[model samples]
Target chain A: MHDLDVLGVIFILGLTCYAMRAGGYVLAASMRDDGIAARFLRLAPGNLFIAFIVGGCLSGGLAGLVGTMVALVTMAVTAREWVALSAGFGAAIATSAIAP
Target chain B: MTAAGFRRGLVAALPFLLSNGAAGLVMGLTYKGLGLGASHAILFSLLVYSATAQAITLSMWASPLPVAAMVVACIATNSRYLLMGAHLRQLFGGLAPRKILLSLFLLADASWLMTSSDADRNGPDAGYLLGSSIPMAIGWVGGTALAYAAPLATNGPLKLAAALLPTMFIATLLPSQWKNAASPWPWLISAVVALLVSHFVDPSWSMLIGGGCGTLVSMMERTDA
Candidate 1:
């Protein structure tokens, strides 16, 4: 492969991601602290990430399902992110190893 | 670049490095499995810094790479950032354009979430944002390097790393503060919408739809008040 080819891909992909992120700020520069809009923005992060997590789990299948539940229960009971995460990771690893 | 900002950012970002490292390790392993060179993996992480985009690119690794398709896929996968950026702008738009632009560079969803949640109490702090981002960026790049440089065993434990990304999200969103903040209905509705849309439509779009609908439900509550 040509050296220039790799650079070209990086340039295109990097620029695209950067543009989408920066462009949103530019477009919304004039936005005021409108009540509804602010509320939406405030809620957006939690909502978006939650949705993304759901989608990620879908792709994860059984491992995702079991891991997520384990993590949720652990977090609820212990309130320790690391512990919850370890439980989830161990479940996923074990499930994948035995099943796959 | 105040010392305080850097310190806070670094501290805030340190916890997330684990999840980011896991993600980067997976990407690195995938690239290595594809037989790409270390330089290729490093460059991809440095430039893209996106697991979804890099994962898609990995699927298309070939002699004559489908460069165009890969670019399209990257853009489509990253479109969620648009909403993230909007959220950030609303929180911190008063800052100088340069600082805001700089923060946007290498911004990850986890950082955005952490920063946004912080903005609720302390106003927009570029220093904090930068602090958090530095460690995360390092984790991603360093994790990729470790994967290639060391060539660790690819067993069930390694594959389990993939699950960390989503679990990280759960950890971030399900903290006691968030749980006590409000009713669970909005989050539940959003998850169901996202799950169904992801099943029927392209999973990428499910994020926007679920978040959009969930935010709308939240707005309705605001209206009722």
Candidate 2:
């Protein structure tokens, strides 16, 4: 085992992230206005956002799941981001406090 | 950028800053625990500017560094940003190369979402994009510095605070987008696939796979319709 060069690792990681971020713009230039890819991009963010949180919520266990449900229901009903977030956080914190 | 525009962006990003800060604090403490110095942690936060990517980097850091493995790991975790940038094509698509470079370099999920939502609701403004980005950069880098200067545990109140962060994206999505969703099947399928992938595959690749699957399904549905 050997300690890696800290700065080198950071540089490579940073460059990789930049490439991924910029690569989208380069590829997007070819996207037709009404193309399938265009439509996909339009709806992809929300779906991707959902996917991003799935693991986090699942790992949080039952409390996390309940909290997520509360948040989703609150958002659906009230359409208020903050209020829904509060409901979710309240559930998570309360559940953690009681169970942890 | 107009002062008002910039201020509005900053205010809009404030709540996100809190969540980002909590995550940053945890990361900073982790770096310290790993025997990395404060300067190194700060540089890492500034350059990478992603809590998830930073976390993956930290986990991947080991003897001999497994540099190739770490690169692949970061790519898998961050492939979402590619889609995010594509989403912004309509907004940043027309800008000069230099301007686009600056904006894309600073972009993150929170800023990208806020900027895109703002464009959809209120029309795209370059200033708004910068407005949203600057605050997030501050929150992320500032949070790391604060945490390195004063380390904090990941659990306890911090854990609860961190727990609350992910749902913000869902809340952002449902308020306006959910009502307008042509069919909920794509999202449902994506979420289920993501859950399954998270269980079987490395969590790092789950989001990209799930998102790709969701996008493909949605495209196919659109074609069918």
Q: In order, what fnat does every candidate score?
A: 0.50, 0.52
Q: Evaluate every candidate with DockQ and list the scores.
A: 0.43, 0.43
Q: Give the CA lDDT, 0 to 100, for residue B38 in model 2.
A: 79
- The complex in candidate 2 yields a DockQ of 0.43
lDDT of 2 by residue, B1-225 (tens): 356766778788877677767656656766766777778888899988876577545544556676775676566556667767767776766765566767788889778888888888777766777788887887778787887676465566555655445444344455454542567787788789988887787654676578668767776774422
Task: Show where candidate 1 strays beyond 4 Å.
Answer: A1-13, A16-29, A76-82, A96-100, B1-23, B30-40, B48-96, B103-136, B163-182, B223-225
Clashing pairs in 2: A2-B64
lDDT of 1 by residue, B1-225 (tens): 356766777897896678678657767776666566789779889888876566545544555666765665565456657667777777776776676788788688778877777767676776677788888999898888888878486554664564344444344345542532256667788899988887676565666678667757766663421
Model 1 TM-score?
0.62
Q: Give the candidate number with the greatest lDDT.
A: 2
Candidate 1 lDDT by residue in tens digits, A1-100: 7657776787777787788677667767554445454445455556555666676677777877777778877888887656776788787778776777
Question: Positional deviation of B132 in candidate 1, in angstroms?
Answer: 6.4
Q: In TM-score terms, which candidate is top? A: 2
Model 2 regions lying over 4 Å from their true place: A1-13, A24-28, A74-86, B1-41, B50-95, B108-132, B163-181, B196-199, B206-208, B223-225
Clashes of each: 2, 1
